[model samples]
Target: MKQLIIAEKPSVARDIASVLGATQKSKNYIEGKNVIVTWALGHLLGLKMPEDYNKDWTTWEMNTLPMIPKKTGIKPLPKTRPQLKAISQLANRADVSEAVIATDAGREGELVARWILQYVKFKKPVKRLWISSQTDKAIKDGFKNLKPSKMYDDLYYSAIARAESDWLVGLNVTRALTVKYKDSLSAGRVQTPTLAMVRRQEEKQETFKPENYFTLDLTYQGLSGKLQLKNPRQYKERQELEKLIKQVEGTPIKVVDINEKTKKEGAPLPYDLTEMQREANARYQYSAKKTLSIIQRLYETHKIVTYPRTDSKYLTTDLKQTMKDRLQAVTVMDSDRVKGIIRNGGTVLQKSVFQDKKVTDHHGLIPTEQAPRLEKLDNEELKIYRLIVERFLGLFEEPFVSTNQTIKAEVKGYIFLFRQSKVETYGWKQEKETTQKRVDFKIGQVIPANFVINKELTTPPASLNEGTLLGQMEKHNLGTPATRAEIIEKLISSELMERSNSKLSVTPKGKQLLTLVNPSLVTPELTQKWEISLEKIAQGQLNYQAFIKEIEQETTALVKEIKMSEDNYVDHSLTTKVCPDCGEKLREKNTRDGKIYVCSSEGCSYRRRKDPKLSNRRCSQCKKKMEILENKNGAYFKCKNCNITEKLDPKGKKNKKMTKHETNRLMKKVNQEEEQESPLALALKAAMEKK
Candidate 1:
């Protein structure tokens, strides 16, 4: 009898199949004498939408909301039902004695396989293959110690709770807000809190007040020093400043003390997904999602990196044995760095980097045994690969050592201090550090210095960018590493957030939604506390049913809050177009997919997808993309924002600036296209223009 092994994606399945000797490939699965391997397309199924359970849930009605299902269920995604059917058929195959769950060895991976099995009613006993890397040895050992499926029952329960809780909280709150306010606004347990944080940051920026202050500065031969004061920079009165400056103008500066010490700083831990994304954002301005995609390609296509969606920045102790091979593989990418580490006796292993207990679902992302061909990488891939490779090599390099010298002086009985740092070793990676000039000073040495008032203003906090936003989200436990990128992106897609370059701005709609939301719902503490419960469910410390009960109660209360609130909502998105179905004003909106016009009425069925027929011409006033507007009058260009209109430039017009040769070149191209135009199409155009 053969054991059926299921993997998370086709690429993973092929890797497993090749290793397990499942050489007989078929359309759905690969089979061998003792084993068969198949794959899932990320997620083949998801929780059923509200409308699936009852017809009343179809419309966005506040009274019919909080549409709690008797039981949340699994449904095959419409586009992937064929694959789900194949997996079910393979599970029921008579020759397969048992099943192996070889999906990604994490909570989400478990859910992917469990849902498929539950829907198929696969009754056979099952085992799990939990391994971090796709190396041959790792896979072999993982199979040697296959875990019982029952061991991860708690994890499955936690996964279910997470999904169901999102549906309950997100759907109920979103529908209630949409209906009550007569606008399409979405809120979530994780994203609402995240959005609130963003709005809070914007509010802080908007309300910030700056105060100008002055600091007393003293400059010597080549060094600058600051004199100590009660309120360092706040010299409230100009007379008091002039008095202090006059008092210390010609005073001799005496060095009272010289204190120095040497210190060492170890290399940073390897990249988790969040850290990797943050670094990519800092250096290349790549979005978190973009970084994730690039790293995934490096792992799957190039086969040079390990898994991408890890949280731990430390490796398992067992990885020590494979360090040499990993080190050699990375040398192919960075010969000078890795080769030097290998040439010298490897450096001392820090316990901070090899703790097993600290590792969660996966260890820190590192390079694999395969030597990376630098030429094979795209520009961004090369950057991400270099980042991972450098971190991997850094583990074997020496720590950075530096010494500091602090000089203390007195001016008119006021204490003054200065510091200079000198690096003793450029260790680990060649990072830029503070380099100070070598200066010699003695105790009780008096030197003349000049002082001036260095005036400055108190600056407001920096705005939230994608990198800082991810860091904050992680700090508050708002979402998982795997889900944080999408959460930030979803806020932008919902039009709750606007972005200019890296900085994020909360739209007026986002602020309105935040004000309407329950105070408890928009605080990170609420969802963060719930995350604790989810973790407990995963560890078997808390029952999943109990968690679900809490979610149900929370949902009921949230819906009730919306129903009872005295604050009224107005649909600000109202447009000039009248709804054909209910005679309400339609709202012009932009979605990720395209533009759409929706009726403002809660129950109205009138909504149309408007193909704006965007134009290449840019608006002169706002510089936004213009849309093509064609009517009985004539074809014209209209700017959506500034309402600027200009008639479309007549085609085949000669460029006055073009030289004869250039004009001929342009005319030749146009003539070629004109000649290709069919006779019937030309005739139709002519007839329509005449009308």
Candidate 2:
């Protein structure tokens, strides 16, 4: 009998089918000599919503909350029901005797396939094909040595516990807050804590008090020293600094001490999703979500990089043998880097990069053994690819060697120190050294004297950007690398956080929600503690049922506290604009596209885009074409990605004048341009061919 292999998505299923020679295409599957391949488009089902179990749960009433059921049933997702039906039939086909799960080889992936099996009631023996990348060779190897599906039972349980617990806590708390405050506020097991982090940072900014301070610097011929008073480096008062400046006005500065230490810094760990996202955010100013998307394309579309969602930065010991192959793959791109890598890595691998016990979900993100064509990469993809390449190359290169020089100077009794760093070797950074900027001071050497007073103000902490937010999320265990970007975006889209250029600032509405929610709900430590327990469940150290009970208990306490609180919640997003239909104040809300002003009245259904919507014409500011949209009033044009808008000029007076023929011709030209692949698309095509 033939075996049926199910993958997480069609793209992945295609990879498996190609590798296994499943050439014949069926309705929702591919057929081979003895095997059939089908795919579930990501998740075909989810845990049943509370309202699905009880009709009363549909209404937003606090009385019907804590919507706990004895057993949460699963249902087919409406959008992919047809595909699900097809896969179900494929799984139960008489020719199929056994099944294989080829979904993403992670905790969430296990749940995806297991849920499909449970829902379809597939009774045949099941095996799992677990591999990190979708490269042709990796797929073949994974299928060659498939593991029993039971091996991932604990992982599936862990994922179910997380999902069901999120539903319990998120749905109940969201309902309670919405009912209490009469605003659409959401609290998640993970998202709430993530929002809290941004709120706390804002609190720091609001309370910050900048203080002005002054420093007196004394410099002689070749010696420089900052004047000190009472052993403090800077004078808190300008008057105090001036007094110190006068005291040492004529004192000659002389070198007191010079010290040097040779130091070496080991290469950084390989790219984990968080580290890569952080680097992209810092260097290229790309958002975490953007970095994740780019890297995912690099992994899946180009087959150049490994899995993008991994948290581990250390490779397994088994991967050590394959390092040379990975290195060889990049030789065509940079032979010098490959040569350097081979020189150092031909022996034992770096001790820091091969710790098996340190690895968790997957090995660190690395390149597949597919040679890259650099000329095909676009600007952004190339930037991210270079980062991964440099990091991977570092694993095979020597540690960065440097010598640190510290020089000390004294003016009368006051003293100051300065530092100079010299690179002994650039090793992995691959930078050329042409000049050594250094100041040499001989002991007891005196130089011409001068004093200057420098004044500065104490600065507040930097505003939270995507990079900083991801770092904060990682630190607090607020969300996984795969989910942190979405959480931040969610906060921004919910009007709880605003993305200003690069920094993230909490909205006033965000603070109000934080105040109204249960204190523990916003604390990341609670989520982090839950993550610890979930890890246990995945490892079979704890039963998922016990974990669910804990979440239910916590949910009960949180709901009780929220109900008992005498505090009042005011809608901070309430705007003065009155809804024409209901004469109630409009509420400001944020969406992925832009801002919107909606009627506060429950059934009024009146809404307006804060950023004006479409026009077929171009924007005057950015000179980009705009979209046209209509609210209750009239049609307007807006450039959603930029700040450009205009009301309808149906008379064609304000818009660029164009005859019908000319407009049609220009539109045809634009359509032709849109049909072609982007530059990054060219890169993906190149990498795919390399395979």
Candidate 3:
């Protein structure tokens, strides 16, 4: 009998297989004399939706407001069906008596593997391979100390509870809002509240009142240069600055306090997805979506970084033996640039890189055993890899040191103050040229000390940019790494926010949506509570069912409130013309060039052509109308409707190409898939197939 190892993705599976000596590889699984390895494509199976329970629920209707099934079930997505079949076959093999769940050590990862096992009805004894870092040593150590799958039962329950509750609240509320508001608006547990948060910030910014403040500059002559205010300490009134200026404007000031304190600056904490995205956004002006996509490719395709989406920034203590190897590997890959930092035969061990407390689920992104090969990667991949390497090297270097000076002077009756700080050395900052680092300085080491009194200055309030705004948001955990990128992307896609000069500004549509939507739906506090509750459930301190029940009750009350609201939902896209037959308002829908008015009232035989497509054809994939490109052998159609391109090439470009045999096989496969439908889908079909 062999041990079966299941991983979250193909890349991770390959790494684990290589480490475990499973050299014989198949379509999706690797085999050895004593072990077999397979993988889930993120998720081989997931919780079924309400529509899976009944065909009638496909179209939104008020009657299906609270569609709760007695039991939720799982189904494999169409694309991953083949992979799921392969995994199930491997899991059920008679020789494979024991299984190792090597999926990502997270809630979602646990659910992805567990659901597949449950769906396939596998009865093998299962163990879990929970490792944060994807190094060879880590894998071997993890295998040696595998724990029973039952240990994570509470975690699994929590994950399932989260999925089910999200499905219920998200689907029900989205349907209710769409139907009641009579628009295509969709809301969710994470995104809706996130959207509300940005809107509030925008609102506060719009309504902000700026007050004028005054300051006086004091210049003192010194050998290094003119030293101004070391600290940005504020002044209460303009008269005080003026009085100070009069007293010390031309007078030679004496340095009274030369306070010097030794400051041991620590290296920066490691990179998490949110921090990385924020840094990229700040330094490179890259969008959050772009950064995430880059990191994803680096993780999945290039295999240069380990689990880029992880929230943890520390390495487990068990990984101490491999640190030197990892450092050597990095040095080999990058050479002299990183090698210079190594001490005592290419070893660079530092306290910042060897902490067990900060690590969870996964360590910070680090260079793998694979050498850095930028030539084969795309520009985005290069950017993400550079970020990872630079940050990693920075973790094992000395901290940046600096000195600060504060000079106080009195002119007439007012006090004049100025301060300045100078960097002594770059330290760790010198290791990686890209990573940004800041240091605090000791007071009164006046290098640029040349401040004169009677100089009036008006401080202009600094405007918000992506970096500063993200910095502030991070200080207050308004969003998580997994969500921050999606939130910013949502703001742009929904046209609720726009980027001007690398700064985020709210659009009119964004402001309008914020005002129109219910306040609680967009606030961050709601999601915070939800996250806290889920955390509690994971800790076994809170009841999962009780948490779910509360969510259901809240959602029900929200739906009812939306139904009873007196304010009419406004569709700004609507036009002056009303449907001729139904008297319902007509609205302008988006088109390639402009907009077209279409009568949205149900069962109304009315539609106006404001901006029809210049050409007529249909996209096979999306089943939407599009413009056709006629050629000799075939016509190519680009679906302006859904952005799908279909081959109709006269030059033998395959147009929905499928052989008669292939078509028959496909239909048979579809039938087979339908036969193996989920528990929810089977029940729904049995109950409502005839209707």
Model 3: per-residue Cα lDDT over 390-485, one tens digit each:
777766666777665545543333344445556666666773334323323334332232443233344434545555555554554545565466
Any residue pairs clashing in model 1, and if so which?
Answer: none
Predicted candidate 1 versus true structure: per-residue lDDT over 457-548, tens digit per residue:
88998988888889989999998888888788778877888778888888878888988988889999989999999989998999999989
Would you list the C-alpha lDDT of every candidate in the order shown?
0.81, 0.79, 0.66
Please estimate how well model 3 matches the true structure, expressed as its whole-model Cα lDDT.
0.66
What ranking emerges by lDDT with the best candidate at the front?
Answer: 1, 2, 3
lDDT of 1: 0.81
Error of 2 at 458 (Å): 1.4
Query: What TM-score would candidate 2 get against the native?
Result: 0.87
TM-score of 3: 0.76
Off by over 4 Å in 3: 14-32, 53-59, 133-141, 209-214, 222-254, 332-334, 344-353, 431-480, 487-513, 516-518, 575-599, 602-648, 651-691
Question: Model 2, range 1-691, lDDT digits (tens) per residue?
Answer: 8999988777677778888888999878999998999988767777776667899876768888777888887887666789889888888789999999988788778877888989999999999998887778888888889999898888899989877887788778877887877777767778788888888888899899988778776654444565546744356777886776677777776778889999988888998999899999999899887788788767766788998889999899988777778889888767876876677645433578899999887999998888887775657878899889878877777777888887777776777766677888887667755545666668887755577677877899888888888888898877677777767776776667788789888777788888888889888889999988988999999999999998989999999988898888778788988998889999887665578898888778888888665445888878788988776987778787785667777675685678987886685445323212211123222322221
Q: Tell me the spans in candidate 2 whose CA falls farther than 4 Å from its real position.
A: 220-234, 245-256, 343-349, 411-413, 432-434, 443-450, 592-594, 608-612, 617-691
